[model samples]
Target chain A: MKKHETAGPTLLRQLTYRLAVFTLIFAILDVGLVVWTYTSQPEALGEQLLTLEASKLERSPFLSPDELTGPPGARSWSARAVYPARANPDHPNRSGSLMDWTRRERLEHSIRISGVRRIERGGSPEWVWMELEADSIRPYIPVILNELLTHVALPLVPLLALMLIFNVLAARRILQPLRQAEREIERLDAEKMTTRLTEPSAPREVNALVRAVNRALQRLDDTMVRLRSFTSNAAHELRTPLSIIQLSLERLPESDHRTELQLDVSQLNRLVGQMLDLTRADTMEFDTGTILDLADIGRDIVSDMTPMAYSANRELHFDDFGSAMVSGHAEAIYRIYRNLVDNAFLHAPGESPIEVSAGPGPQISVRDYGPGICEADLSNIFEPLWRKDRRRNDGAGLGLSIVKRLAEAHHGTVSVQNMNGSGALFTVHFQEGMPESGDLKQTLPS
Target chain B: MRLLLIEDSKRLASLIRDGLQDQGFAVDWCETLNEVKLLRQLVQYDLLLLDLGLPDGDGLSLVRSMRRREDTTPILIITAHGELDDRVVGLDAGADDYLCKPFQLPELVSRCRALLRRPGASLSTVLSAGNVLFDSSTRALLVSGNLVDATAREINLLEHLLRRTGQVVPRPVLENSLYSMENAVTPNALEASVSRLRKRLKMAAANVQIRTVHGVGYVLFEPK
Candidate 1:
């Protein structure tokens, strides 16, 4: 999808390109129409030229016809004859000889008889016969083209440019809603599954697409709801029986077998609890309004788990650097530290102290002085159900994964590294500052 | 001591009741919240072990109603819903403590005992860790059935540590308990008292020992 988006032209570029293309097409069609009209109606051009010549003759009535007609061999106009009213009273200009003579001359020289005109120049009636050489009009072509350009094409250039600018702006205006929808979609995630795109005032096609996307989001939210409820129900159903078994086991007489069974039951219990926690971390949304102190939570968890650590022949320590305030759910953050400590207890050497510290910043770290993680397993340590020794029943390997998910749900990051000497240190960095209110809604399964 | 246990599951309820009885508590087992209302009228229970999920209604409603009427019987919520939100809600509804299900019976008994040991609750005034015991009413210390002599400050520190056995008690808490707000205390005052108490316990041959968690606090545990 990213490749295609980069490869395709943007809406503004496409609109400008198409507008320029159509403008060129219209300009070409306009020029063609002007040329065709002039060529198809040559008589109109002849009539216009003849009227201009007659007007020039009227301004200078004393000029001889020989001066008006150019030399014979030149490509120019010629005055065939000038007839007075008295010379032919009834139809003076309808003389057969004159007509025949003009026709013969036109055929011989390929001359065009422009027109015949009657005029009373200097108070005397007269008829004039005019003819022009067809080839002589070639010099006038540039003038006609200049006129057409000045009258039509020149004005259209600015108009076309204005249209192009308007088209680009209009295209951007029409797509504004779609850009808004894009931003909303970009912000969508599993936590904000309830968010939907809304663009009622967009164009018909874009609105249709927005509605379709909203419907898809609704379906996804429904699926998430179903999944969360299923997880909750499964947890309740499994935990009840496990509780009964644990209780029943505690009633048995003390023996090696009983202790082994009890150990097995407790391990199973931890696995179930961790699995549920993993599921909740995946689906739960944090309430941004809940402000918690990281240092306080760390101290509380270390204090709470001290008894467990003591029974395991290990010591738990907590270090607080004033109060580290952040926006998060208390229990989820507690779970993260608790899981890290639990992991440390599982790996650290007996009686070695584990340290849990909360911070100079919005961060918490747990360090265990034990055989540090191997280089190969460092990357996969947080993966669910990944155990160093698969045969061992000590842990179900879900604790680290739960820690990672819960940390992420609070907008935090988790990392692990081996100490310089002999230990592994796990650190979680939480985002500081209050999250935007109403960004997410808590939707826990009933 | 008498206690009321509310749970819906019969087998689990019976196991819990037996476990509590073995711990020397007269346990009255009921399966619903309605039976609890009727039982409360007849006998005043020292502690209430209420399960959040019951047949009649949510146990939180009962906790809220009990606290509303000024009844402070020290309700301990036992539930399979172990999510943090549920625990917070339970506590906010006036429950004294929360214990998620699938827990060992020993843990349940310890939590019950802890709640019952609150100042107003009707229970023995004796708090013990391993072979060492501290009587809150008489301010007495006993080790292996022998009385041990200790100063008032040492006994005060001992009582606080014994109350949270096998748990880390922060230095500030111990200091605040040892010296009142008006009294000025030196930085090493708590360490001095702890060392003195440690010597007394060693002389008395008490099994429990106070171990310091560097940069944190101290914990009292029985060495294996």
Candidate 2:
């Protein structure tokens, strides 16, 4: 599996988002506490200062104003004294008595500050004004903010880093079985039906998937075994009777009738053989790594079939070009060449030479001088049971199909093309660098 | 020579048996593995033509069992299984040779003769190809029922080529079997012998001819 860079939103990214949200909530709570305490505390301090100053003035009504001007105790405090003056009816110079001064006079003359409070506590109930400096409350604001940073944000940043790291590790740990299951599935070769995916040591949901896949494979394997058996049995059942017929025919005396019987029997045998070859090509287990010389195989086949070609009045020749060593099953390669040569003999014109050649490219070509295939029939040449015309019907039409299938089994291709002047050319090309073995297993249906 | 044929198909067995008998082999046909097992204990045979799909048991198992008991009789498997693996497995299980089904009678006869040519194998005294016959017992060569004189070396070359009737006989094999190593081997020694043998056989009106398979060797066959 290819590793991809983290460029999008992944599990880890979403985890980081949740961590940021948690930090935001912590900030709101921390800052909200400081703001609430700062606004409410100054008003309570002003009221306490006013009460103490009023009681002091009641004890010493003649205390000098200078005595209360400087700072008092823990708070910066001061007091203000007021004398009531109202219009006199009888004597213009006389001042109104302290008791006679109505509540209206005190209410109109009162002064207000943010941290100041007024109180009336003398025997005559006179009003005293006390205030705390604004600078006194401003200092505590910076102290509270510093305390917040040290206690909350400072430690929280590292804790969040540790949490992020731990989350990623935990996520990978939880997904380990899933990755293992994927590897096991990837390694399973369909050709090797005995291999089964291992039970993932994961949660129950993941195990269920693995078990289901294994069951499906078991069913498929059973079906394959049955199909293989059927093919083998069918070949046996069909060929045995054909053998009996051919043997019985051979026991008769030689005559024109026997010759005809021989021809029909031979034809029947070829058809049966091709039919089985087709089945085997489709279903047989093939392996690689066996090295064989293509030219050597061609020479041997060409030599063996020389007599047949001679009787047909067609000369068969092998144009050897050193050793064309290829990696494939020897039997399979032999069959490919045998089929090509045999097809040429059956279809090529009499008295013409059929040349089988090998090359350095690991290619084998069989050229026959006969009526070249029609353009329309070329596309369907490799299809099973394809006969161009009744006049040319000499086979069951399974030969070329079998050739195509066998070539494909070796990871090769079979192609045919009409020659310029005459005849047809059939070539099989094997890919280079084929694995010695198990390459076919990799291609099996999974 | 005596031969045992284990085959389940009655018609195929009968035809093969008649053909073998005509070829001077005393053939006993058994339709099942049990019959073969019983008959082998009672008699000794020169050859066994076994079919793979027997009624009672697989012919491969029979071959394996016979081999385990140290029986070295040449086993020629006539089977419908002609796959490469099938051939390899059959040979590995102790079969001497294998012939796929739907084979010609002449090829089967030839293969049987070839197998019997091994050392210590009991073969028929009379060997014939085309119109020529060589009787080992009487040391006589007859063509068209008349005696034809031939030298010992020529007879050996002719016999070797005739046994493998249609297959090519390489020059070296023919030369090695015809001459001894102690003799100063001449380049044309085999050629001279083959030329004289060929002319004599032609003068004698033998039905077969020795044709050279160019660059390979010679193959003897009846001209059609």
Candidate 3:
């Protein structure tokens, strides 16, 4: 809710952080699965097969050949037991199974008998148990894995990689408009209040936020309207009575009553006029917008006040300003001018010439030779009713404050610094124009 | 010289008319813009002191419309709104000058006379602030209509001051005007001349002000 705070995290940084997190977590899980599988059942199963085969070979290694079952009496009592015919198997058998075997047969089979019988385990016999179990269970494990490596994982790796890349791309796509909106908000300018956020076609989550900001701006505009009304009203209210009193004084004779009264009234009127203008300027919109010739306003106020400057023994001079133009209410811009010139005249003590100049950047500076404002007070000197010294009563203490507000309205800024030794320099800055069509235009207040 | 006053209020118009008549300037007054326009078309008044507020139309717009018709008669704007911008606008609208309201009638008369006399040099003849008047052509000085013989230095300073009235002529510029580009003048001499002039100007006879602008220089105010 604080004014001028920046929205956090730009799109570029958000994308980078998200991609890194995804890659890191994926690598961890992939390694974890590999480690878990490598330490499981296969190696232990291989060793158990060797132990069981040794035990089976020690019991009844040769007797199982005569009848192949019933321990020479368990099978074939009808045909009588002779040499079990190898030719009946129609080529050498790998596992000599003839009938359904119970769990006991599988448990009782020995590794010693496995070598003597024509089990066909000559080539790569170390994996015989595994081979036997695997052969009996399923063939084509190598074939299936080879096909998976070539036809599945090979293509899937690239597909998954593309998905991850697209995730980062998608996130940026989704956030791009919002990020732009945030940046636009960050760049909201008081001088450019007429400028609003070009609300993006964004997620609905952010729609209300945009609406809220626009509403806030609407309120500000409404407040400014009322403030201007009050200012205009206040000026009239003060002007009427002052005018009446002046007229009444004028009707009096040319006696001491007229002279003394007129002198005091003159001073009083000057003070009141300055104060009212200050109040009006304090609340006026920053960019009511009119292009002004700075060269023009500077020329006028300087000439008008020159007589005062001359009487004080201080010279008033304007340095050349070439074709410098500004945009703002002409009156407001003049207020900026009056404050700087008045300050210069008040301080210079007729010793130094006030040198006012406009620069290449459409900027202007007023230099003086009076004792400069204190460094501590410089920051707040533009605040209303800010008087460094309590005793001086020439002004209502709003001159410089009006200067600051008027400058801001033009989308410009003003700064003051100490002159070489005993004076102050006030600088007003304006940016170059942005090619607004047509020649310069000025508007009068309705 | 007869002067025409355009004002909307009856009491204010009569008050101004009476006060101006007492000063010996023939004063004719009107209470509305239409009447003022009718009068302007007929009479050849030396000056027009126009009030900005009217019963019928804007006084400023009227001024602008008059200028559009090539009416170059001198105009002095009197208004209740005294913002600097207003003064600028009035002048830009072809007014010869502007005065914020509640003015001294003597001041107003004097201003009209000055504006009328501007084509010539009658205004420079007399400094009227304290009834001090110096006549260059006659080589005479008068305070409240009584002639007072002045030292030659005072006379010389008064003549120069009158010519550059209402402008701060720098001490250097004044010195240059006095001594010329080749006169090797001493600092003490200029100070002595200015000091004597200041003392005499402040004397009750003239209340003629020759103010020293601290470090800058000196200026004599334009007579009002």
Candidate with maximal DockQ:
1
Per-residue lDDT of B95-134 in model 3, one digit per residue for the tens? 9989876566655775676576554522345444446666
Among incorrect, acceptable, medium and high, the docking class of model 3 is: incorrect
TM-score of the second chain, each candidate in turn, equals: 0.94, 0.84, 0.67
* Candidate 2 local Cα displacement, residue B183, angstroms: 7.1
Which segments of model 3 are wrong by more than 4 Å? A1-177, A191-193, A199-212, A249-268, A279-303, A306-337, A344-372, A389-393, A406-446, B8-31, B80-88, B100-111, B120-219, B222-224
Q: What is the lDDT ranking, best to worst?
A: 1, 2, 3
- In candidate 1, stretches whose alpha carbon ends up further than 4 angstroms from where it belongs are A1-7, A13-25, A40-141, A144-148, A255-257, A374-379, A383-393, A433-446, B181-184, B222-224
Q: What TM-score number comes out for model 1?
A: 0.81
**How well is each residue in A223-283 modelled by candidate 2, as lDDT tens digits?**
8778867876776788878887787777778899988878888887788777777767776
Predicted candidate 3 versus true structure: per-residue lDDT over A1-446, tens digit per residue: 24565589856566667766765576557545543443353343333332333233335444332332211212111112212234255646644443211121232332111222222122411111112322221222333343345555675568666866787788777767676777677776543345566666676666667777878887876776677667766666666566666767776767986888876776677666667676555444334446666766666666557665655656667664576776656666777787888877665665678877766457778888888888788788888777777686656567777777667655578898886767888999875773384343322121
Candidate 2 CAPRI grade: acceptable
Interface RMSD of each: 1.8, 2.2, 5.6
Clashes by residue pair, model 1: none
lDDT by residue (tens digit), candidate 1, A85-147: 445667646542222123213446455555565545788655567766654556346445664
- Which DockQ values do the candidates obtain, in the order shown? 0.65, 0.33, 0.21
